[model samples]
Target: MIWLLDLDNTLVGRDDAFALWAADAVARAGGSGDDLAAIVAADGGGFARKTDVARVIADRLGWEADLPAVVERFRAGILAHVRAYPGVPALLDGLRAEGDRVVVVTNGTSAQQRGKIARCALAPHVDAVVVSEEEGAAKPDPRLLEVALGRVGADGADRRDVWMVGDALHADVAAGRAAGVRTGWVSHGRDAGDGPAPDVVGRTVHDVVAAVRALAAPAGPAPARP
Candidate 1:
């Protein structure tokens, strides 16, 4: 099987990292807890445009830093705090050991996303990494997934053997569906609501791994050519 995973808030604790950065940034700007809360709310769990979030933070905290500087600082802070979920390396290793190909397909700038992957020590585990900025296409656009497939040399593989796993409904699930691949959603303890449904739902990647393993077909003898 070919597993395409998301980077932020999926393999790593992006939300937690952002919260940590937001609190510290707000405090350094002499802002109160309410100010920090407002900034976090504006982040929209990282779905909001980063520039927009930075603008909200600057306005709320009365920061003198320009928008670009604020956004750069925010990116740096998250990179410093982000860490992969426990057992992620081992889980990925197990998948690869069983002849599965794992690729990271994320919607973000190449530098920031690759930095997180390196910081979390996930670079060696995943077979390939695809970032939106590098590919010039983001999720919900099946072309991004196609780029990933081609990167990992699985472009012509059966869609049934491909899985796009992530927390975002529209981006990940919808992208996978459009690409004709199965999807595994990491719910993070929230209901999926009315968005695109996933073939497998789990609170974490580990759960999704288990579900995928159970769903994947067992290896058998090769068919004889007539």
Candidate 2:
């Protein structure tokens, strides 16, 4: 089995980091500056992809420094505030123990994703980390997910063995499903009103891991092949 994960609020709680950065950046942005509502709307209710948020905020603020640098500062702060959702490592380790492949497919600046992962000690468990800055595409697009699946050699015939778990309905669930990966939505108490959604719903990483464990069980029912 191969598992693809979405970082940010799925595995790493980033609401505080976003609130802090958005508050500062929007204030600096001036005219209409940064409307938290607008940014949140653009995120499609998921955690904002760091580069997307910074670029829009910078464009709105009219900042002159290199855009990457601007994004890096925001990401640095995100890393500082990163607290892994409980049971994340246990989940990852369990998958690995079952001889499953694990990959993290995130859409964000290279510096942003890696910075947070490095700080969070996520590297030891993840087999590959494919970030949009390097993959040349973002989530919900199927491009990065394809890359990760190809690298892991997860065939369409093995669709039941592939899973994409994340908190965002648009990016994680939609994208992962598009890429032929089974989807798991990690609901963090935020209601996702009516929308196209995930294959399974869970309250935390442990819940997600439980679902994964059940799916990967030798005698468990397999998801229809994609």
Candidate 3:
């Protein structure tokens, strides 16, 4: 089986890292208590584009730094806190042990996403990684998933054996369904929401790991070969 995993908020706690980064950025700007909250709010929970976030910070704090400098600071801040969620490393290792291929499919700028993967020590665990900026297509777009499949040497013949595991229903889950592959959604304690339900739903990454293992189990010794 092939596993296509989502990077941010799935394997790693991107929101937690972003909060730490916002605090650090606020301190660096010599802003007060209220400023931190304001900055974090303006960040849109890290969903805002980096350039736009930088501009907002500069305008709000009266900073003279250019966009590039602001972006550099943002990346540095996030990199400093990059960490995988509990059980992620072991999960990847276990999948590899079972001879299952794993690919990271993410939607973000190459620099930012790569930084997270490298800083979090995730590169060695997966077979390949496909970033939206590098691939010219993001999640919810079947093309990006196709690129990931190709990197893992999977063709349409293997689609039935592929699974996309992610936290976002609209993006990751939708993309997998659109690509005609199975999807496992990491609900993270939220409702699964309105849409075609995912083939599997788990409240945590650890749970998802268990589900995948069950799916890939040996099928009772292949029915004793008849």
Candidate 4:
């Protein structure tokens, strides 16, 4: 089986490095501890400068703008907080043990995403790392999935043979469905959804791993909302 996993909130909970940087930026910008957060919420640029979250922070602080320099600092915080969610490593290892090919389908730029992978030590276990920054598009985009499939050779296979696991319905689940792959949602350790549901759901990475190990393959149900 080939697994395309999400990073933030999926592998690691959404206690973002951007949020931490925003906290510090807020203080540096002469605002309250929460002041810079508005920019981060509005901007999604990690270290790649997608939305320029740090630039917004600098602007809010009325400081001279420096995209390159601020990106480095912001990434430092992000890498520092690059802690994986509980049981993530176990699941990845288990999948490898099962002779599965695991590829990280994440969004962000070359530097930002690579930093996380390096800090998290993900390269050794996974087969490949695909990020939107390099692909020129983000998830839920079949183009990105196609590129990933080309990398891992998942083409001509049914959705049942592949599993797309993540925490976000709009992003990961939507991407899975778009790519015509099975879906397993790690719903923030709840492992269960109240309204709609996934083919298989896990509250944590470990539960998903258990489901994967028990099931014959990745034939999953539809996705539900939070």
**Candidate that would win on lDDT:** 1
Q: Write the per-residue lDDT of candidate 3 for residues 1-226, one digit (tens) a residue.
A: 8999999889998878877887776787787778777667767756677778788778766687598898788778888897999889988999899898999999998988998999889999999999999988998998999999999888764777899989888889999999999999998888876965788889987787688678767766544554
lDDT for residue 50 in candidate 2, whole number 0-100 = 49
State the lDDT of candidate 4 residue by residue for 2-50, as single tens digits: 8888877677644566677667767766786456656676554332353
TM-score of 3: 0.85
Model 4 score (lDDT)? 0.72
Relative to the true structure, how large is the alpha-carbon lDDT of every model? 0.92, 0.75, 0.85, 0.72
| Model 2 C-alpha lDDT per residue in residues 1-226, reported as the tens digit of each score | 7778888887777765655666666776664633765654554433556467666656666776476786666666667777767777777887789788889888777877788888778889878888988978888898888888877776553776688888888778888878776888888766778754777788886787687677656885878999
Q: Give candidate 3 misplaced runs (Cα > 4 Å).
A: 30-33, 214-226
Task: Specify the poorest-scoring 10-residue window by lDDT in model 4.
Answer: 42-51
Which candidate number maximizes TM-score? Answer: 1
Q: Pairs clashing in candidate 4? A: 189-203, 191-202, 191-203, 199-221
Candidate 3 achieves a global lDDT of 0.85
Global fold similarity of model 1 (TM-score): 0.94
Candidate 1: how large is its RMSD?
Answer: 4.8
TM-score of each: 0.94, 0.74, 0.85, 0.76
Query: Is candidate 1 or 3 superior in TM-score?
Result: 1
RMSD list, candidates in order: 4.8, 6.5, 3.9, 6.8
Report backbone clashes per prediction.
Answer: 0, 0, 0, 4
Name the lDDT value of residue 164 in candidate 2.
87
Candidate 1: C-alpha lDDT: 0.92
